[model samples]
Target: MQKVTLRFSHNNPSCLPDYRNHSRSLKKVLQELNIPTWQRKRIPFLYYDDELVAAIGFFVCQAYVLQESEPSLHITWAS
Candidate 1:
């Protein structure tokens, strides 16, 4: 069976490449969003079979994004 997971971690650094094909600093992204330091660690990360797909409020990884006409999983995060 295929497995998809949503997990939260405070240690995911920017070394992971983003959908844009470049490394994005999670720290900077959070700061830009005005997410207070205290709340940054509470953000969730979406993973697909162990690959990082998204950093909840920030961005989704390229390999996991859906193309036009493709089936997709709709996700929502509630505070």
Candidate 2:
């Protein structure tokens, strides 16, 4: 699994890419996992201190397991 951070504010920051762009990025990544269209319609989320900060799974990822072999889980973030 990979780690990422996303900061959201009323005024967009130059450091962070536009949140609207997450759809395209998520689609590209989920394509590899063969995520269904229905799931794709689901929203992504982000949390801060157990508080929901954003619906931006497309923004930041938690963990993904592509495959498993006993105690092993082959997980990779979409580039």
Candidate 3:
């Protein structure tokens, strides 16, 4: 069995690597979406083992994206 986890933390978005292989700040993306400052830290971050898989409601990491016909995890975010 694999270990997957979901965490909610006030992390520095600039430190998270994007699917584009760039270190773009998640804060900037959230700001563009008009998300309030107080709510940014409440977003859930998905992880597979220790690697970041996706930031719920945002982007999924390149390496973790599902390929055609590949097995995948179905995640649903509520609230």
Q: Look at candidate 3 and tell me the lDDT of residue 71.
A: 83
lDDT of 3 at 64: 66
Error of 3 at 7 (Å): 0.7
- Candidate 2 residue runs with Cα over 4 Å from true position: 1-24, 47-79
Estimate TM-scores for all models: 0.65, 0.27, 0.67
Q: Which ranges of candidate 3 are over 4 A from the true structure? A: 10-21, 25-34
Candidate 1 pairs with clashing backbones? none
Give the alpha carbon lDDT tens digit for every residue of 10-48 in model 1: 455563435355666667656766888878677787776
- Candidate 2: tens digits of C-alpha lDDT, residues 47-67: 343333343444333232223
Candidate 1, residue 46: CA error in Å? Answer: 0.6
Compare candidates 1 and 3 on TM-score and give the better one.
3
Model 1 Cα RMSD, 1 decimal: 3.0
Encode model 3's per-residue lDDT on 1-79: one tens digit a residue. Answer: 6898888863544534343556566676567568898887788887777666677887776666679999866867777
Give the best candidate by TM-score.
3
Model 1 misplaced stretches (Cα beyond 4 Å): 10-19, 24-36
Question: Which rank order by TM-score, best down to worst?
Answer: 3, 1, 2
